[model samples]
Target: MFDTLPQHLELIVLTFLLAGLVKGVVGLGLPTVAVGLLGLVMPPMQAAAILVVPSTVTNVWQLAAGPRFLGLLKRLWGMLVGIVVGTLLVGWLLAGRNWPAATPLLGVALILYALLGLSNKRFRVAPRHERWLSPLIGVITGGVTAVTGVFVIPAVPFLQALGLEKDDLVQALGLSFTVSTLALAITLSQHGSLLQADVLGLSLLALLPALAGMYLGTWLRSRISPLAFRRCFFGGLLLLGADLAIRGL
Candidate 1:
């Protein structure tokens, strides 16, 4: 939030609305969609600052709504610690220093993430393998988050590869996202990139539309084909991500 309303206030509101819709329909993508779309006009970090509240509230809710929270947390403890270490290491990128590479990095991350979603590839990580790979992926994901303000690159893929049931997978995503959001918030506060208190209220208002859109999307989920919708969603991300990547380059 700024001292005054942003020139593109409507766009920002709509962006959150759409992002919420996506998350409601698919279970995730609020940060990915919101940061990527908003990046077209603002730095990814700025957009990410606005995202802290909504992402945290929603993700915390998601994490709590699942019965598997404790189990997931125990299994993901190492990965969670790694996320913190990695985010702190690269937090400088967002510490009052919007490097030229950040935007491009975000674009590239979105592109890679979109491509992975669209590819329909499935990976498996056995328990033996998870012992080492979990923390590694978390660190990679945290580094990516610190650089790009988006948190889903390797983390999402790694989570998917765990071969959890549908409910467990959803809950797992919630846990990871909640940790990542809090980690990013802490880093941003340490640097004041998250914004000052006066205008922070404006960003919180975004939750209204986001929650509303999520409600709508939840209603629509049973009425539509999620598989078809997801393809379209990833396809759109691919195009948008390419545009951002090209502009950044």
Candidate 2:
């Protein structure tokens, strides 16, 4: 167990906590930041997998705090459906292959998403026309979640564009990730990708740090102006995306 282990274990735990704090405050970023930093200490796949539980718990916290469950439900109906379907399909397709091909794809997607966020016109969904968009978004989200575990960004923008209130946006992102994580967890189990007992222990150890980070982020958010907060959030995305793209090359 990491608790009883040596120096390396301590580093990973600290990293997870810092990553969690960022996510807690900013409302996104667990996968991108944590995975990138932790990858230096552990294998990338292992680092990515370790995030599942903390991310799940944090989202659960956000959803509970938003107190907009019902409204989120009404607004996110399509997106919720879309994420579930997409994750399952993508997970199935990822079975038994080398994951290298996935890196560049993830990088490109992140870059594109960053560009969109920086643009003045954010993407929006026609909430009234739910006949197709919901499922499409779900499938796309699922696929991306399966590949990179960072699909929340795309889903969040769409929900915001749908004109959901801030609380609703928070709830919707939380709920969407909750569903996507569940599906991804199952996929990992089925694919035998979650084999390391030590890794799981490390993930558990990381939870405390995650909680601390969340608190810090929440406190920090209160201090920042809304406009500055928005710029910082999108700027972080842009930097993370650029990092991913460079790594992919």
Candidate 3:
């Protein structure tokens, strides 16, 4: 059935565009913003499926725009692998018509994301301790991602804890998100969640708006401090999360 487009096509376009802008300015959050917003209308699994191409493309770009790929790979291999395993292991949560269960989980994930960003406390994981903690964080991140299509939970905080240089931290996030996107793709495919040709086409077309928004965001990032924007972003997300949570409950 080659339909013209998914329902609410305009909304979908805006979502990718806004999500890309956020990612460009913040250097992350494309999938988070996209999926979270999309969750308002679709299942997490469906939102995740639509997310695959854009997420992989943007994250790969972010990963390549940085230096020292091999070093980041070496340092984060355990967590990367853990993300794949955890995503695959828990994918069944979205394999069936489990939308009721996923919504609250997505809401909770958003709430946690807001809380962590709003707080000023910086959590640090010692160098030696990262060996064990990184994989654990990855696993937890994957599980949450599997259910909610959001991957920042534990993972971003853990990455921040490592104390990498600014550039290195940004690149590391790209690498981690790249893996997470690919893993979620596999899980969705395994469950036939991505079998629709129309959906795939829609996802591909979404990249145009996403890239355009990213370009705009990158320009804005160079001029603005983003402090106020960050607060607004998290605040809006917190309220959205709370609404979703109540609806889900």
Off by over 4 Å in 2: 1-11, 39-44
What clash pairs does model 1 have?
A: none
Give the per-residue lDDT digits (tens) of candidate 2, residues 4-32: 23457777777777777677676876666
Better of 1 and 3 by TM-score: 1
- Which 10 successive residues of model 1 have the least lDDT summed? 193-202
Considering every candidate listed, which one attains the maximal lDDT? Answer: 1
Give model 3's TM-score versus the native structure. 0.95
Q: TM-score winner among the candidates? A: 1
Taking the tens digit of each residue's C-alpha lDDT, what string does model 1 give over 73-190?
8999989988988887788655657778888888899889989999999989988999898899889988988877899989999999999999999999999999999888887778
List candidate 1 segments past 4 Å from native. Answer: 1-5
> C-alpha displacement of 192 in model 3, angstroms?
1.9
Question: How many residue pairs clash in all the candidates, one count each?
Answer: 0, 8, 0
For every candidate structure, what is the RMSD over all alpha carbons to the true structure, in angstroms?
1.5, 3.3, 1.9
Native-referenced Cα lDDT, model 1: 0.86
Candidate 1: residue 173 Cα off by (Å): 0.2
Expressed as tens digits, the lDDT of each residue in 1-249 for candidate 3 is 224336668988999999999988989889878988888887777788888889999999999988979999999999999999899888865464555778888888898898888885688899889899888988999998888889999899899988899999999999999999999888877765454666788889889889998999999997887887788778878987887788888
Models ranked on TM-score: 1, 3, 2
